[model samples]
Target: MSDILKFPKDFYFGSATSATQSEGTFEGDGKGQDIWGKWFELEPEKFYNEVGPYKTTTMYKHYKEDIQLLKQTGHNSFRTSISWARLFPEGHGEVNEKAVAYYRDYFETLRENDIEPFVNLFHFDMPAALQDIGGWENRKVVDYFKEYAKTCFELFGDVVKKWFTFNEPIVHVEMGYLHQYHYPMKVDAALAVKVGYHTALASAYAIKEFKKLKTGGKIGIVLNLSPAYPRSNNEADLKAAEIAEAFQNKSFLDPAIKGEFNPLLIELIKKHDLMPDYDEKDLDVIKENTVDFLGVNYYQPVRVKARDSVPNPDAPFLPTYYFDIYDMPGKKMNPYRGWEIYEKGIYDIALNIKNDYGNIEWMITENGMGVQDEDRFKKDGMIEDDYRIDFYKGHLKWLHKGIQEGSNCVGYQVWTPIDCWSWLNAYKNRYGLIELDLETQERTIKKSGYWFKDLHDNNGFEL
Candidate 1:
C-alpha cells in the first residue's frame, strides 16, 4: 500500500442529518406532531438537560445559511429526511401546502448551491397520528408509509435524485420495541419481530412506488451495519457470531439486497415462537423490490461470544438469549460516546458486501466520532477537533483499502456536517464538522471542517 490513499474522482464526500433532529419548527407551519414532539410533551424531563426537539438548530429557518456552510465544508452531497408529519399532518389524507413549499425551496436551494440532495423518506420519525394506531407493529401503517413515499416522490423527485426508503429500520424495531428506548416503548419480543417485518415491507412498498414513477433516480436503505466479531475461533463462539450477524446485520440486508430473509434467522424466530404474522404476498413484494444501492452506516462492531450459562425459560425473550457481547480487553474506545472505535470494521463491512452480496454498489452513509463538551477543545475561537479529523482518516484508510481490493463502495458521508440534536442524548455528544451554538443558532467552522474540506477537494488524504 502507498502512503497516499486516493479515492475515486467521483466519490461523494458529504454529511447527513434528519429533520426531527435538526428542524426546529415543531408545531407551527401546519406541521402535525411527530412522535418525538409528542414524547417531549409527555415527558420533557426525559430529554437531555430538558432540551426537547423544539430546540434544534432551526434548519427549517436557517437552511439557506446552512447550505452555504455545506459549500464551505466541501460537501458535494448531503442527506436529510422529509418530516412525515410535516408533509401529511395526520399521516395521510391531507397535504400541508406550506410544508411542501418549504421542502421544495429547501431542495432547490441545495441544488442551486451545487449540492446534490439525497432525501430519505423515513428516519425514525413516525407521525403521532399513525402511532396512535399501533405504529409499525400494525400492518396498516405500512400502507400509510407507502402513500407518504409516493407523495414525496411526486413532489420533489425532480430536484432529489437519490432516495432512501428508511434510515436504520432496525433501530426502530430494537430501540422502539425491544429495548424500550423510543416512543411507544415496549419490551415484547414478538412485537419487535412484527415491527421489523412491517418496516421492511414498508421499504419494499416504497421502492415499488418509486419504480412505478420512473423518476430516473436510485433508491436504497441506510443500514447501520456493524460486523460481528467472535471472541475466538471455537465452534460455539463462531455460531454465536453468526447468530449475532443474522440478527443485527442480515435481518434487513438479505431482504433489501437478496430479496429474501436469512433462513437461519427464520429458524431462530420460529424456535422462539416469535414469528411475525405476515401475508405471503408481502414477501413477494420484498422479493421483487430489492434496492438499487445500499447506504451503510458504520460506527462500531459487535463483539460476540457464546452464552456462558444454560438458558432460563422464564426470562423474557431477547436477541441476546443465544449469545453475549464480549467485552474484549485492549479494544479501541471512544469513551465520550461509550462506543468501540474499530476503524478496520469499515473495511470488513465493505469486503463482506463485496464477497457475500455480489459487490453491490454502496457508500458509507454515516460515520463520525461524537464527543462530549466539545467546547472545552476550543482554542482561539475555534474548536480544534483534531480528534475528529484523525477519526475520519483512520476509517477512510481502511475504506480505501477495501475499494482497492474490489469493494464496490463509491462514497463516504460523515454522520453530520453540523452539530444537531440527537435523540434522548440531545446535544450531550456533539458530532459535527461545524460547531453550533444552541443558544444563538450560530455556526462556526471547526478545525475538522477545514481538514474535511481539504480531503474532499483532493479526493483523498494521506495515510
Candidate 2:
C-alpha cells in the first residue's frame, strides 16, 4: 500500500451502534419493552436461531470497558441512540431516572475519553407502549416522539454536541409496513405512506424543539441512502430508476435536507390514492426545520429496470409496482451477506448530495461489511478480518475522491465498533472492528481494528 490517499485534518473516524442492538438490559433497571422485545416474545422463531433481543453484547453492563476498547480502536467520534423505552418506560408520562443516569454517564464517559458522542434520538426501537397505540401511523405518536426528542436533548445535550432526530427512519416504513420484516408487520401501502409521512413530521418537530432550546449544537438525521442505477439508458429503464430513486433515497433525503417531499414521490402516492393524512401546518414545520447536517448509512446500491409485466390491479399497491430489481451481470457482491458491493456508490451518493442537496455538511455514519460464521477465519485468538479492512479502503478511496471534488463530506464511521445483535438477523452476521464473544462477553479487537487505528491516527490510509 502506498501513502497516497489522505482525508481532511478534522475528518472524524469512529463507529456506530444502537441501544437495542448493544445494550442487553432489556426490561431491566426500569427499562420498558421495545418493539423488538415485544416482537421476539410474540414470535421467537422470527429471529435467527431463536436468539431474541434479551441478551446482546451487554453494553449496559460493560460500557466502561467498551469505552476503553473504543479508545484502543482510535475512535474520535461515536454514534449511538438512547432507547426511547429505556428513557421513558411507557413512552410518555414518567421518566426513568435510572436510564437517565445511565445515558448521562455514558455520554460523559465518552467525552472524558475525548470521544465526541453523536447521539441519535430513535433507532427503530420504538417503545411498545407507543406502538400499542398505533406507533407512527397515528398523528398523536408524532407529538409523543417530539417530547422524547426534547427530553433527550435536555438531559444529554451538554456532553453530546451532535444530535440526530432518527436513524434510518425509512427502514421502519419499508421493512415494517411494506415488507413485513419488522414488528407490526403489515403490507398496506397506504399505511406505509402514513407511517413515513408521520415519521418525517416527527423529525421536523424534533428539529423545531432543538432550535427552540438554543443548544448551540447541530441536529440532523441519519439516512441510509442507496443510489439507484438504471440497467439501461432506455426511457422505460430510466423512468423505473427515477421512481426507485424517489422512493428509496429521496423520500427521506429530500424531506430531511430540503424540507420537502420529492414531487415525483408525491405524484406517485396520489396516483395510488396513498396520500397520507396531513395538516398543512405540519408541512410548514417541515419546510422550516431542516437538518443542520446529514448522516448517511450507505451499504449498497439499488439497481433497477422497468417492470417486465403489467401490475395486477387487485394486488395491494407497493413501490415495486413501478420497477423490478435489476441483477446486473458480473456485479461484485459480498459472499457472506449477499449484498452487492459497489464502492463507487459512495462517490455517487457524495456527488448527489453536493450537486443536489446544497453540499450540506455530512458524514458516513454507517458503512461496514457483515460476514457470517466469522470465527472460521480466527487465527491466534484474534479474528483476522482483512476483508473488512479492504472493504473500508475501497469505500474510503471513493469518499476521498468525492471530498476532493467539493462534496463537503467530513467523516466516515463504520457500522459498529464491536459485534452486536442485529435485529431479526440477530448475531447471524457480524460487522465490527472488534470480535465479540457472546458467551463470555469478551471484546477482542480484530486485525481490522488495528488497521482502523492506523487509518484514524493518520487521518487516512494508503491506496
Model-by-model lDDT, in order? 0.93, 0.93
lDDT of 2 by residue, 1-463 (tens): 4567889998899999999999987455999999999999999999999998878989998999999999999899999999999989899989999999999999999999999999999999989999999999889999999999988888887778999999998899999999999999999999999999999999999999999988788999999999999999999999999999999999999999999999999999999889987888999999999999999999999999999999999998889899999999999999878999999999999999999999999999999999999988899999998999999999999999999999999889998999999998999899999988998888999999999999989888777
Q: Which residue pairs come into collision in candidate 1?
A: none
RMSD in Å for model 1:
1.2
- Cα error, candidate 1, residue 291 (Å): 0.2
Cα RMSD, each candidate:
1.2, 0.9
Query: What TM-score do all the candidates reach, one by one?
Result: 0.99, 0.99
TM-score for predicted model 2 compared with the true structure: 0.99
**lDDT at residue 65 of model 2 (Cα atoms):** 94
Give the lDDT of residue 417 in candidate 2. Answer: 92
